[model samples]
Every structure is written in structure tokens, then in C-alpha cells.
Target chain A: MASQTRQWLLTNPPVADIKLSGDDATFSLVTKELPPVGPNQALVKTLYLSNDPAQRTWIQKDQDPERLYLPPVQKDTPMKAFGICEVVQSEAENLKKGDLVLTEANWTEYSVQDAAALRPVQPDPEHGIKPTHFLGSLGFTGMTAYWGLVDVVRTTASDTVVVSGAAGATGSMVVQIAKHLVGCKRIIGIAGSDEKCRWVESLGADTCINYKSKSFKEDLIKATEGYVEVYYDNVGGEILDLMLTRMKRHGRIAACGAISNYNNGNEKQISNWNEVIFNRIEIRGLIVLDAMPKMGEIMETLSKGVKDGKIKMTEESETIVKSKFEDIPSTWMMLFQGGNQGKLITQLV
Target chain B: MASQTRQWLLTNPPVADIKLSGDDATFSLVTKELPPVGPNQALVKTLYLSNDPAQRTWIQKDQDPERLYLPPVQKDTPMKAFGICEVVQSEAENLKKGDLVLTEANWTEYSVQDAAALRPVQPDPEHGIKPTHFLGSLGFTGMTAYWGLVDVVRTTASDTVVVSGAAGATGSMVVQIAKHLVGCKRIIGIAGSDEKCRWVESLGADTCINYKSKSFKEDLIKATEGYVEVYYDNVGGEILDLMLTRMKRHGRIAACGAISNYNNGNEKQISNWNEVIFNRIEIRGLIVLDAMPKMGEIMETLSKGVKDGKIKMTEESETIVKSKFEDIPSTWMMLFQGGNQGKLITQLV
Candidate 1:
């Protein structure tokens, strides 16, 4: 029997709100024969894929490579998805069959990728790190959180930190890190729903506000008391704009992800620019991959934190949607709402 | 002799653009009896008042003390004007008669103020320094330029710096400092007219574009080529918004003043916030007064720079309009246009 491959291809980049299906679908499901593994290449079967909020921005229309840190996903190609894959066949010296590795498995059932691109993952759990954790706390999601709060914002016991998207994947990690590990004086979380806020608070946030509430701006103001020393911003739009006015002089902002503005792109909605000057605040944007050289260092701290029970384990925070390849787009959309509060990932076996 | 003081009072703050005198006047000329000097106070006659673009923001309406670096000017008060003043009478041990001091002389011919608020200016010229040079180079105007370029953005020889309001007082200083002092390889300036651009270029800026011209944005794009390493922003809003996109990785911006939005208050204009993150840029706002502890040190370098001809001598750059105290408001409005292409001051005697 001829081997088969199933993958989702980005057919068009969205102009405004994203479309995953129908006539205006940004992505399409395609079936083809699995390509044979060539020199320095490995054939792999994707087990789990990251359904990232930033993934939508990666497929933005007319993405000027100059503007975007990562180039726009090429139209009519497999939509970029970084995931854990099991090596089915290998022609590279470093890899063998049945070995699980982390690479761009994408939204595909089987992929032939450069062996150099793959990093070998222990097939078995090491100190409670599951292979799916590579898509969760042990991966870029965790790395982003660690970098944003610890390295970027440099939160301390003296700081009053406010984190937007407190319930999402990277955000969830940041909340736990700032509160449980870093021991910040106050860690305020901004989430979409009251339940999500509650969950975020349980993770270690001092107080969490529902941004969708009628009195969100008022509540956030009251919560922060106009003394936000450090702001780890995950959702970029109105919340980020409001936070600008509330920051203390010389405040540090870790511009993580603008999840809310992922579709339209965060535009001219910000009004408190004068505050950025008045307060002498610093806003720094980061691509977590830029810190790949620090990966060993990050993993050491993150792994130790997890092992020491300072940071929550994958099973505690993991929110996975076991869905088919056809449902990847819809599954990705579901996480946008506050309903999916924990570390979001798609179990794409 | 019972003397009368001629002064300008901020009667109302503007809603949009400023109105100096009209049915909706923001300022009014008034004459009052000069109050007696009290203990720890000095009576002074204003010699020269700074016609600053930022002076307008100090008079902005409903300014929250929390939002503004300096408190807003209270309505029905002598409008704030920092200037060179002749000490006519003194009750403080630190001040004496005939001494010239740099202080809040207001838009008044004569006024009594706290002696501690005044810094005694040298009565005689030293190293070619004049009383007017205190307002030009040794004052807060020049201190703002030095702190912004040397400390805030920390521009190096390799930097491509863009300065807005390139013909204005602080901007003119920045153009000279970034070029002759810092020796930055390329410095582009944005002014409001062809004449002002030429003046800015003459002040050591590599090229100066007329922001009012039809090809302004295009010319700016072609000039910087999306590699603005450091931006000394004297004018904010659209130019700053555009610069957010044009920044290189880890670009730095020194937010000295936003003169263009001084009346409008730089609202809802910034759209390229994502670029602030994508490029890992850092923007810092400065209130030059915040660095007052370093004043003696700043004056030392500025004085030396002038003496060595590295920075322009006061006579070479001072744009003094000999006018009555009542003309302070109108003269200030004139500086907003690019015509006043030097260190602006109203020579009030």
C-alpha cells in the first residue's frame, strides 16, 4: 500500500478577521503521497502541534519580512506548526526510527524535514516532562514566559506586575513564574472571563480581572493603583494602551504577544503615547526564538523549577483539544475566547 | 518707587489648537503692582523669556499631576516662563542685587520669587559665554539635548539618527551634538520648511527634509532605509508613529518633546506598536529637569564645547525677538512654525 500524507495548507492570508473554511478560507486540507526521506532528512509522524495565538499573525497578508520577525507562511504550503514528531524513517546520522524529536511537524500527519532542524526529545518522561510538554511549559511557550517576566520585565518583590492574557499558554506560565517562583509583591492578571481570572489567580496571580467585564478599565485602574512597575503584556490593544497611562516612571514593559489584535493587527487604537514619555517607560518586543542560544540556560531553570515543584507540571496546566487535522482552524479559534484558560495545545496524532 | 509689573496670565487652556488672545483666549496680558520681596525671596526683572514649544504643554487643560512630569499651569496665574532675570532686591543670603539668575521669571517684567528657585548666572562673560547663552546652551534646553543623545538613546558613531523639529532650539542642539559631539555617521532631520531644513543641515545634520513638502514621508523613507538606530523625537504623533515601523532591531528613541502634539496631546495616533515589539525597540521620555543633579556637569561640557567651536556659540544660534512682555504669547505661537530656526527667546527688558 502506498503511504499517504495529510496536511493543512495556507491558501490565503486573512485581511481582517481570519477565515479557516468556506470560499474565503485562509487554510485548506490537502491529501498527497508521503515523500521519501532523502539525504540529511527524516520522515516523521506528528503527535502534537502548538495551536498558538501568534500563529495567526504568522499568516498575515502582505507580511513584509522586514516588519515580521518570522516570514509570512507561504500561500499553498503546509501552515507552519511546531510540534513533537516520532521519527518513522531517517537518513541522517543522528536520528533513528521511533525517536521523538521537536521540529516543524506542522499541521501534517507525516513530513519529510531536514534532520538538522529537529532536536531529539526523550521519548519517555524526564522529571515529569511529557513529550506534549515540548508544546507546553518545556517549549517556546514556557521560554517566552520566562524571558518576558524574568529577563525582560525583571520583576522583583518590590514590583507591582500586571499581566494581560493571564489565562493563555504563555501568560499562564508568566503568572506562575512571577508569583510562585519570582515572588513578586503583586501580580495582577487580565483575562477574558471571571472563571478564567479565578483559574489564573489559582496559578499564583494576586488578583485577576475579567477584561470583558463592563468595568474592566475601572477595575484594572483600581487593581494597579497607577503604580505598575512592570507590565508583561500578552494581549496588545486596549488593555496595553490603558496600561501605558498606569505605568510608574521608568516602568518596564515586556511586549510579548498582542493576542487580541492578532486578526486586524494592533493599529492606531493606542492613545496614551505621551504617557510613554511622561513616565520614561521602556517597551521591548521579543521573538522567543531570538533567545534560542539561551535555551539550555532557560531549560535548566524551567526544568529545575518544575522538578522542585516551584512551577506547575504539564498535567496541572495543560488544556489540550484532541481534534482532527480538518478542525485545526476552528480549534485554534476556540482558544481566543477565555474558555480555553490553561496551556493551550492541539493533540494532533 | 511703587513699580508695576507687566505680565501674561493663562486664562484658559485650549481644546484643540492654542488661542493666545480672542473670545476663546488661552492667555491674557495683565499689569499689577509688584509685590514686596519676603524672607528667602528675591525680586527680579525678567531680561529674556524662553519661547518654548513645550511651554504650551505646561498650560494644557485638566493635566493630571500624575500624568505630567511638571504640574499643569493653574488658570488665572502668571503663565510659566523660565528666563534670565536681573535680581533687583534680595532677602535671601544666597542672592544679592545686580546678580542675574536663571529661574521662573514668568512672562513678567518684574516679580518676587523664592530665592532657592533661582540659580545665579555669571554677571560677566566667561569662555565667550553671555547671559543669553544660559537660555541657549547652559539652560534646560541644551541639557535636554545632551541627556537625550548621550544618556537616553546613547547614540554611537555607527548610528543613523533621525531628529524631528530639527530647526527648533533643542532639536538644533541635538543636530549639532549628534553630529559634531557624538560623531554619528548619518543624521537626518525633519523640519517644517525648505529654509528650516537647510538651516538644520548647516547645523551638522547630513540631510534635512521639509515635513510640509509633498514628498516628505517618501523622502524620509528613502533617507533612513528602515534602519533608524536612534531617534531623538522632539515632534511626536505621525512622525513618531512612522518611526516605530522604520526602527532597526533594538532601536532606541529619546522622547524629549512632542511639539506637534503639544496642543493636541499626541492622542490615538500611534499605530505601529507591534513594530516596537517586533524590532525590540526601546523609547525613553525625559524631563531634562529630572537630571538637575547633573546640571553643573552638563554646563561644563556645553561650555567647553562652545569654547572649542564644537557646539555653536550663543550669538551664532540664538533667535531673539526683541518684543514687549505682552507679545510673549504671540512670539511663542510663532516658534511652532519652522521659521524660528534657532534657540528661540523673547528679549524682554
Candidate 2:
């Protein structure tokens, strides 16, 4: 057994703009004795960690617990993430040694967690599904995109749906779900790069525009035909402001994420706000954990869709970063730097 | 009969700011001979004009007619407003001389409109409902307040509603309705002055905060206790931004008006916008004209409430501007300048 466990701790207050020089000042790498397995608990070794934009929200400084859907990571504590772990020692009947499971763990090499809290990943070897599918398609990423489009806005075949962050995991899931499962009349995507836009279009989106392009505004206007009925907003900021102005009457916005605004307290401003009144728009913020009550129902629908060949979990564009245990902060910084594509995963093993 | 009638014309492209010096450069007062009443038309004398903040939205330049719930007033044309007009001559059987009616008449001494477009005001002497009530409570102003509360967010008695512009027409109306009609549990009001705050409380708001106060942020925090369930926003600016941070789970915003942003393009920015996602907020925009299909139903309910003395159309504090014929631009500008209180009305007669 390893005598010591290495973990990352947040030393400074939260800020998304990471200067690797100053970044080391924000997070600390420390060594601790491996926690002993106790009653109803299992000691596990983390194999992989999911890299996501929402991580920025979890460590927000001084955020009220009542206001946040997720509990904010406190200062000077271990950084939080969902990790695929292998149970090495178990004190519970359901959790056996060598069993692979998914659980919320810290930025540590080893964690002793409640065995009952672990979710057993059921990989479909026949369907070419890997264990990472639990962290990508069938995980928080897929559930968010599925329910956000279905429950948040109820995208229908009669409606035209536009998705921001269309090249990323949640955004790409939303595009595919709206196209294949919901069968929307027109599905448009907004991505950061031309290659990302093309990739989004290839995923059955009717059209995808590069927001980085000089003609993005004009291109979006032409593509939407001045009618954006449903917008699954993964990137908030200037894109959200522009969408507000062009929304058709009774427009619906599914605020899944605000990746653009998740940087160093530099959140963007929405000035064309009065258009909300003029167009009778509806903007609803979505958090996947809030959909827990409907977990079984939505998961059944998702599984059925996948089994029926209606939806693809995600393509093979997953950006998996293999990093040393001490390089956790740098691995996380890449999510904010736009240096990743699709679902960014860190192979902790 | 008066040989000629004076009317205010939009000489320049629309902008919300009205400097009496440069303002006159935007509006031109001209005299024109009365048009003969054609078949199906009635020539009427303007009685009372509703000087509203929404009038600013009507004259916005380069606005797409398809995007606006109300048609944007074009340049080189008479400015548009709802008014109490007395029929002077009628060529249609439903209309007659001396009959008081309501209409979307221009800023003119006289308007020749289709008799079918005129809504006869049924003033109830027993209840003291005057002909102006149609322009105040029973008209667009009252309907906006009533439906914006009833339909926009479906505010219930269990909800705590905070209203902005609590001293203005639609705002005060929202306060009264949320309290008396909707019977909300805790009603909070946001106003420009301590005096306006007091007036809002007098209208049955449980607490009213002056946004201009030095401790406005602390005051709002103390009042809400970080549990704002719903916000009826009429003044959209910094106040709206502040309210966003304290919203409780599943918070709803009735986007009725943005009086603060209706200036010379000095719209305030919302920085802590991620709170929407954190709190799972739902924001919906409202336009009174969009409720036309539900007009008769809502109007009937409003009239019943007034007949039952449950809701006040408005207190006697209606700011009636008895302006001289040429000073139409100055009178209309008072709505934007906060120079008048309550529902600012221009007594054209």
C-alpha cells in the first residue's frame, strides 16, 4: 500500500484567470497519510477526473450555500471533482475490492469514501462503450444536455433551437439530442472555432456558426432567419446579449452554462435587456443536480434513445489529458484557457 | 369649430433623451387644417394624453416592427399615445358627437380615426370611475400592471414579491395588485426616494426601500434575508442587478419595464449574472399588448375587483400635466426626467 497520498488544496480565493506563475500561489500540493477504511466505507484509488467549466462555480469565494445549487468548495480545502475510482479496501457488502466505481472525491491519489455513495459504472463492451462513458455521455454532461433541452425548454419539432458551446460536451449533447431525439425543425450551433463549427454541423445540426468569425452576428441573423424560438445557452456574455435582441416572440433560453463569463470576475454585461420585454422572452437557468428527482425517468429515456440508435453519447473527440498527480491545477487551467475540445478528461492514474 | 389643429411631429430620428434645447430639434409643432370625417371615420378632439415611459419605446428609431409588440412611431409622423378623445364629428353609426372614447391617438389637438377603433369609456358614477379611468386603471396602464403580475410570473400568495419603480404608474399598480389582488406573503418595493418608498408602503407593500439611499445594498439584504422568491421589475438597472444576487431557488422575474434604462443609452450592467444559474432563476419579459387575447377576461376580473373596492385604479396622485399646445415635447420629457409623480397625464384640452 502507498504510505502517503498526494492531494491539491486551494490556498487562495477563487479566480478563473490563472497565471501559472501566480497559479501556484492559488493551489498547494501536500502529502497526507492514506485514510483508513472504516465502517460502511471503501478506500479507493482515483483513476480519472472530469474536467469541466462548472468547476469554476464550485469554488466561488464567499458564495452563500442557500444561493448555490452546488455546495461551493471552501478556501484551503481539497479541490473537488468527480473521479472514476477503483475500490481497494471495502467494509460494505455492495462494494467489493477491485470493483470500479464513480464518486465525488478530492484532488487526491487515494480517498476513503462511503461505499453506498459510489455509483457502479456499467460499461457496454458489446456497444463499444468504455467506462469513461459514465463520466461523459451517461454522466452529468449528458444528463445536463438531455434534460436542459427536454425539461427546461421542451424543444419540439416545431421550434428552431440554437445552442452555444456547440462543439463542447454539454453543448454537443444538446445539439444531438435536439436533432435526433427531439427532432427540432432547425438546429443551429454557435462555436468558438470554424473547425468546431464544422464538427457541430456534422453532428446533425442544421447549421453551426463560428462566433469568433467577423461575420458571426450577420451569419447568425441569416441562419436563424430572424427567428430564434429556443436557445440552449452554454456560453453566456456577448452571445447571450446578441441572442436577446434577435429572439422571436415567446423565445425560450436554457442557460446551461456561462463559460465565457466564468473568468477572473470579468463577467460580461447584457445591455439589450429591454428586448426581453419587447419579445416576451423566457430565460431559465439550469443545473443538472436539480433534476435529481426525475433521474430514473430521464435516464430511462436516455438509455432507450441510445439503445434505439436515436442519440450518440458523444463522438471520439474527447480531449483526455494524462498528467502527474502534482499537476492537477495546470490540468484544470486548460478548461478555462480554451485549450481543450469536447469533454476534457484528466487520467489520474 | 377650430379652424386649425396643432400636432407634435418627430422631426429627427428617435432617442430617449430630451433636452429642451436639443429636444425641440427632435420634435416639431405644426398647424394643419382638420381633415373631413370620411365614411367609417370620426374626427375627435384630444381630451387627455397618457404621458408614459413606454412612449419612449414607441418612438425608438430603426426598430423592427415585427420585433415590437407595439408599432414603432416613424420619424416625420405624429407621436403616438393612448388618449381620452371626445367625438366631434362622426360618419359611422356606432359613433356620435360628444361621446368620450379611448384610442391610440397621436400627439395632436385632433385625430381622425376609424370609429371601429374607438373604445367607449363606461364611467361608473356610483363607483367614481371617471372617463380617465380607462386611460389610467382600465386602460393599458392598469392592464399592464394586472396581467404582468397575473400572467407573467403567476405570482402567488406564498411568494415574496419585490417590485421596482414602486411609485410609478405600472409599478404602484404592481405593488397594489401583488398585495391586494394576488395576496403575496411579503411585498417589497424599490423606489427612487424615501418619500416614494413611504407611498409604496402605503399602497400595502410590506416594506419599501429607497434605492438611492447609501445603505441601499445592506437595506435590501436585510429586508430580503437572501430569500427573494419573485421580482416585479419596472426599473431595470442597478436595482435589477442587486436583486439578482439574493433570489431564492426557482426565483421568477416579471420583466415589465426598464425605466432606468430608458434614457440616452446609459443602461446599467448586470455583473453577478451567474446567480441566475446558481439560484435556478426564471426571467420572463412582459408586454401588455401581448395579452390582447386575454384582454376581455383580465379586464372583467379587474373591473370586478374595482367594483368590489379590492383594488384602486390609482390613488388621486395622478400627475396630470396641463401643458400649453406648443410645450408637448417638454410635458412628455417629464416621464423620463422623474419631474412628475404617479401616472403623468397631459391634459390636452
Candidate 3:
């Protein structure tokens, strides 16, 4: 009997200044014989992979990406990402062949992962939840929201939280968590479009402002009423400055990511940081991976919310050619252009 | 008999971008009858008047000099400041004649103040401590150091603390508090000259660096070995930027005062603010007046430390001519040029 395995490879190296384009990229898919798994490792079939803005950070070579939390992905290596996978074969003591797992699996049809790297995913079939929930609400995005709000920003029921990038995976989760769990008095969400703003409002945010509109700063101030107690910042640059000025005395800011400056060669400098001193604000950056110890509590609460219909999970999936594994580069390009809604994934099946 | 009051006034209003000259200033000693003290008020005889860098901010029409901690001195009016005074008459129940007091009195021979405005000072006659200690150690400078280190910075015993302006009143106290009270493992102090650096070391700092030296940054880095956990910032600008780069992850910065930028027309923009976000640093500006509730605790601890010899107190006093009070504008001019040391007090006796 022969074993089955699949792999994706990057054909050409990316140029520093060039924006990823059709001629600049190629993806190659290969079917090869499977190798035996070690005692602590499991063979997993990729179910759902997360396509995050952070992925773009990995593909660009010229940028000095030294994030405190996420390890930078190496060029030409199997793209490292968090995904929900089904265990096809397992020699690990903690996992079974049929068990669903969440792990840092590569962008490929099959992955051989260390059992230690695999987080066992017990599906609550009674609640009718799908495996994709593990990649969104019950996964990294959910955990990021949980730690950034609870631990980093320390948002409370009386806090007025204004979150940017408010309609995406982490932002959406943050809005829901602030509304349902934190019981924040005012939740202002800033998204790129009216559609996203409406989507955020539907997810229990008190109000949603579209950054694409010319009146972003005015709308944000009016929506927040000049009293933002906590700012969950994902989008940096001018948006950050506007938020900094409107922050209340003793306001807390959780600097989760700077998606706005991720691709730009020149990082934006905040002109009014003296506001931090004048207002006596507390601003801290956080990465969810550093808060792994609290994942169990986060998952338990999210799972209960999902079962009770208090939390609504939405994902925008963009499927690309399986053999265009090289198109991973271009697929990621679509994200920076605001081409996709939720998660960007490629299917090999 | 008609009682007389001596007062100094800023006579020559400073023009655009010109240093203040005490010449053209005015001082008057009169035999006019003393004003009657109102209920809840006391007549205080000036003992020692405080002159600080913040006074320069008050002369400017642009800056809102009324800080929560320090009220701004009105132009051409008697120079108001924190002063050590002897109570000559008191209507309020808590105070009595002959008692030493600390209050926001002016540069004058006598000031009628609300009894509520005066804080009774308990003199330590055994150690030869005088009323001036109330202006330096037990006054705003002491409270500034106490609240900034204990509350704003949230320093721990295992942390390393770096204090800029380390030989100044508040900075000196900060170094002592961090070393003696908090038991910080490493305390690096930065001052203007080798003499000031020596003064900082005498205050129990583990190491002291003269910031005026060309190799200041290198010396600072070598002193802490790249582990600065808490930064008690008094002098901002370049020194602050240097500390920002060397701060440990999750470091806390207590922005007590930006003396370096106070006279620079408030136009100095800190170029290294991105470090605040990238390193997850927590920087908070503090006004010691906002920390009044902890005054009793701080006073008791400091008094005990003084008695136990765990803390040492020193004062650099410069007595200006009472007739030369008209030269206050020039005296203040000398402050920014680092002309005076320790507590700059104008004695009207």
C-alpha cells in the first residue's frame, strides 16, 4: 500500500519594491509519498486555514518585521499559519486519528505536526458548530480579542471602547466580546466600508463608523462623545492620532497591530504622543500568543456564547486553485487591497 | 502701627524669544496696614520661597500654566509658589501661631492665606531638620517622587529604575525612594554634571551618569546592562528618547515633568514614540496633587526612613538679596541655564 501526501512551493522570490502581481508569482503543487509519523507527531488534513493581514507582513522582505508576539514567517518555507485540521493518522498519545486539531500547519493538503504543536479540538456537535469556528471564534482571532480586551486594555463595564479594524476577524470578535462579556457601555467600531459597519452593528456594537467615509474622525468623535476610555487599536497612522486626541484622562489603549502601516515602506509617526503624557494614558502592545495560558477560559466562554446564540460567527472565505499554491502570494495580495471579507484559504481537495 | 508687606513683581514683560532680565523688575517694601485674615485663613510669614523650572512656563501667555498640581502665577502679580512659612496668626481650628506651615505663598514678606491652604509641618528638631525640608523633601518634590515611583511606575524590588534630572529635588528623592523603599536591584541616575552625578550617587543610586558627557548614552547603557525597568522621567526630549530605546519590555515610565521641553516653546516632538507601542511600554504623566490621598502614608514612611538613617536629606540653598527681589525675572532666567542647584529659594526675611 502506498501513502499519499501533498506540498505547495514558492517558485520565484519576491522583489522588495514590487507589489505582488500576476506575472511576479507562481504556485506549484506536488503529490508525493508520505513519511512515517513519529510517536509525538500527528498527520493532519488541512480543514480551514486563516488568511490574516499579518500574512502579508510575512511575504514582504524589505520591511523590518520584528513583532514581539508572532514569529516572522521565513521566506520560501511552507507558509506557517494557524488552521483547523483533521487528524488522518496519529501516533501521539493525546490525539486520535479522527480527532480534529488546531495547529500551526503549513499551506498544504497534508501536514506532519508534532503532537505538542497540536491542540485537540473537541467539537460540540450538540450545538451544531462547525470546525471553521475553531479558526474564527474559538481560535486565534477569538483568543486575540479575549486577551487584548481583558488583560491588555482591561476593559470594564463602564468603559467606552473604540476599536479600529472593527469588522475583520479579530475586530469582529472584539466587538462581540466587549458587548456580551465585558458589558461595555459604549462600543464604537471602525471598519473600512458601510457593509462592514453594518455587519459590526449587527454583531452587537453600539455604533459602527466607516473609515472609508471622509468624516471618519468627526464621526468617531461624535459616536464616542469625546470620551474614549479604552482604545483597541489594530489600524495605526492617522487613525491612531485622532483617537489619541479624543481619549479621556487615564484612558487605556491596547496596541494589537498596525495593519494600516503593514505594507507601507515608511511607518507613520504619531505627532501628538505628548497627549499620552498630558492625559496620563496607558498604551500597551499585545500579542495573543503571549496570553496562551488564558485560552481555555476564553474558549469556554466563547463556546457557551455560541451555544446560546449570543455570539454570531461570520467568515469571508476566498477559495483559490489548489495547484496555485504559488498563488498563495497573490491570494495574500488580495487582502491588502481589501478584496476579501473574512479568512483567505486555498483548497487542495 | 501700620504693618508693611514686601513683594516682588515681574515688571518687564518678556518680549518674543528674549531671556528675562531681573533689571527693570520692581520690588516694594511698605508700612501699609496688613490685610485681615478671613475665617478658615491664616497670616503666614514667609520663610523660604520655591523657584522651579515650571515658573518659566507661567510667564508665557500661551501655556495653560494652571496644572492640577501647581497653580500658575499671574503675570505682573506677586510670584506665587510653594513656600515654607511661619504662622503668625490663625483663625482656623487646626493651626496656631508659631507653627511651621507649607502653603502656596508668594515671593513676599507676608501672605494672608486660607487656613485650609496651609499644611502643618512637624519639625524634626533632633536631626536638625528645618522648615526648608518641608519645601524640599516633605513637600512637592517628595510627593512628586513618591507618587511617580510607587503609583505611576508601579516599580518592584527586582526592577531597574533610571531617573533623569537625578540630582534635582524630585529626581534625587526618586532615586532614594527606589533604592531604599522599593529595594530596586539597579538604580541609574542621570544628571547634568559630574558634581550632580556625585550628588545622585550619595543619595544611594547604584550608578550616576553625567548626561552632558559625550558618552552619556553609552555610559547609561553600560550602567544598566540594557535592563531599565522603570523610567522616572522629569527631563524629557533627548534623554527620554535614550531611555525609551533601553527600556525593558513592559517597562513603565512616570512622566513627572518635561523640563527640557518646558522652555522650548512646547514645540519639541519626541521622535521615538513608536518605541512606546512596539515595546509595549506604559508611560503615564503624573501630578502629585492628584495623589493627595497617599500623602499621610508617604510622610510617615519618609519620616521613619529619615529617623532610621535609611534615607539621607540634603539641600542646596541660594539666598538672594531682599532688595534684589526686583531681579527675580533675571534669577528665573538663570534657572533654565542650570545656574542654581538643589532648591532655589528666595528669602524675604
Each model's lDDT: 0.83, 0.83, 0.72
**What is residue A337's positional error in candidate 3, in angstroms?**
4.7
Order of models, best DockQ first: 2, 1, 3
User: For residues B1-349, what per-residue lDDT tens digits would candidate 2 score against the true structure?
Assistant: 6657888887775555654556547778888887777899998899888888877877776767887787788888888888899999889999889999999877899888898899888789888787777877777888999888888888888999998888888888888888888899999998888888888898889999988889999999999995878999987878888889878888999999887887656343778788888778999999887888999998897788788887665544477878787777888887776665568888864
Off by over 4 Å in 2: A266-268, A313-315, B266-268, B313-315
lDDT of 2 at A152: 88
lDDT of 3 by residue, A1-349 (tens): 2277555554443433334445555334566676778788888988666677765555555333442334545555566667778898888888887898888876776778899998877776677666766776777778888899999888999998998888777888898889998899989999889987887888888999998899887888799775789999887777887787778878888888777666554443454555566667787877676677887888788888887777774433222324244455556556566555544454434
TM-score of each candidate structure, all chains considered together: 0.95, 0.97, 0.80
On residues B1-349, what C-alpha lDDT tens digit does candidate 1 reach at each position? 3378877888987656888657889888888998777899988888888888777777878777888888888899988878999889889998888899999888888888899899888833566778887887778888999988988888899999999988888888999989988899899999888987888888899999988899988899999895889999988889998888778888899988877677665567776777877788887888886778888898788877887888876454888888876678778788776548678888974
- For TM-score, candidate 2 versus 3, the one ahead is 2
Q: Which residue pairs clash in candidate 3?
A: A26-A326, A27-A326, B22-B330, B40-B115, B41-B115
DockQ of 1: 0.65
Note the residue pairs that clash in candidate 2: none
Please give, for residues B1-349, the per-residue lDDT of candidate 3 as tens digits: 1156766654433323434434543332233356888898888888767777655545554434322233445556766567778888888898988988888776677778888788888777787566777777767778888888998778889898999888776888888889898899989998888987887888888889998899987898798675678999888777887787777777888987777766554353544444565677777877776778988888788778778777675544232324254554455555566655555566653
**lDDT: which candidate is best?**
1
Could you tell me which 10 consecutive residues in candidate 3 chain B have the lowest summed lDDT?
B61-70
Error of 1 at B292 (Å): 2.1
RMSD (Cα, Å) of candidate 1?
2.2
Ranking by lDDT: 1, 2, 3
